[model samples]
Target: MAFKHKSTLLILTAGVFSCTPAWAASVSVVGLFKDKAIVSIDGGRPRTLSVGQTVQGVKLVAADSGSASFDVDGKRRTLGMGQSFAGGAQPGARQSVSLTADARGHFAAAGSLNGYPMTFLVDTGATSIAISAAEAKRIGLDYKAGEVTGVGTAAGVVPAWRVKFNTVKVGGITVSQVDGMVVETGLSVPLLGMSFLNRMEMRRDGQTMTLTQRY
Candidate 1:
């Protein structure tokens, strides 16, 4: 049977993960079965966790018996079996990074928001970078000081906050003064949207995506 929950699960907040220096830790999906998954955090001992359970703040959101969704550092990210998020290139090392698609053809990356660790789900459909209120609060983003707005999802219209991120970094590419949206509720993951993507040269070939800094 599929694991289901009421919409209220959207607002559930938990403890944040341990902090390491930049490019120190990583997360990966090892095996996934309906409602259950095996994952590795920071390359430590691998373990099995049920949906909604968290391992060092990496909460398992959903499992399709093939791919699994995880809430890493307050951002929702999906990954198929065997896909991993790695510590990025060294500081001032390079200005480009490549991402490989998981078995489910989804692209994800390890990054940061305002120097806070985060996981980014590639969403070309999103107009700007999108974060959940839970995430905005965790990362100390002053979204309420920005404009109030609403976002239309399949469920309905939900309240959102329009704010600017001081800096968003993925691998070695960092974009400053990025526009972002904070959904008041009903958003589980933070989307790596166009506000950041538009600043880079994005190219996809088969299962690999290459992102290079533009300026």
Candidate 2:
């Protein structure tokens, strides 16, 4: 079973890790259909569930092609197929967001930067959150005036701006004053890296990665 305190064996290449297990108590959206779904709890096993069915502390309130609505610990949560919900809670409780890998086994999360909608590719190896210069401008960020730096990319080294974000959010979790980098070249997708991940308790089981707030 995956948990926060245990360190799973991870292979590192060029100081970067891939498909490694990271963060939480686990819950998964195994299958999603027009109005039905299958979910699992704690990675123990998979079970087929339907609307209004409660299994392993998760109550499937509703299900559709794009999402599954669940009630956990008296709070309602909705997760897309393949995503997990281990850290589902209200504002006062432990907050978290769980993501499942796509066919390529890469974890991508739907969230926002400074309240503007954006997609984030979860990259644990990165030292800080990284965004493209275009994205920073789209989100009205003044990263151009931030600290100048150099960042290595697949193409080559490029000029980058180190900036602190006012807010970064995923699902119900929000983190503020997040240190990040705005690469002037060669980045299309923003990376959700250590600057944000380090603040959460993380765990993984198979293709699912869960992040829970440390506090």
TM-score each candidate. Answer: 0.59, 0.60
Candidate 2 segments exceeding 4 Å error: 1-88
Q: How high a TM-score does candidate 1 get?
A: 0.59
Candidate 2 lDDT by residue in tens digits, 1-215: 00011111222122122221122234578799866787655433356778878754567898888998887766788899889865535446777666777665667766668866566777887778888898888878898898887877766677888899998876556789988888887776678888899999888889888888774
Candidate 2 clashing pairs?
22-202, 22-203, 22-204, 23-202, 23-203
Predicted structure with the largest TM-score when compared to the true one: 2
| Candidate 1 lDDT by residue in tens digits, 1-215 | 11111222222222222222233235677788999988766543467989989754567899987799887655667888888765444556446667777665666666678867677677787788888899999988888998887777656677788898998877556679998888887667677888888888888889888887777
> Which runs in model 1 stand beyond 4 Å of their true positions?
1-94
lDDT of 1 at 115: 66
Residue-level lDDT for 212 in candidate 2: 82
* Residue 164, candidate 2: alpha-carbon lDDT: 91
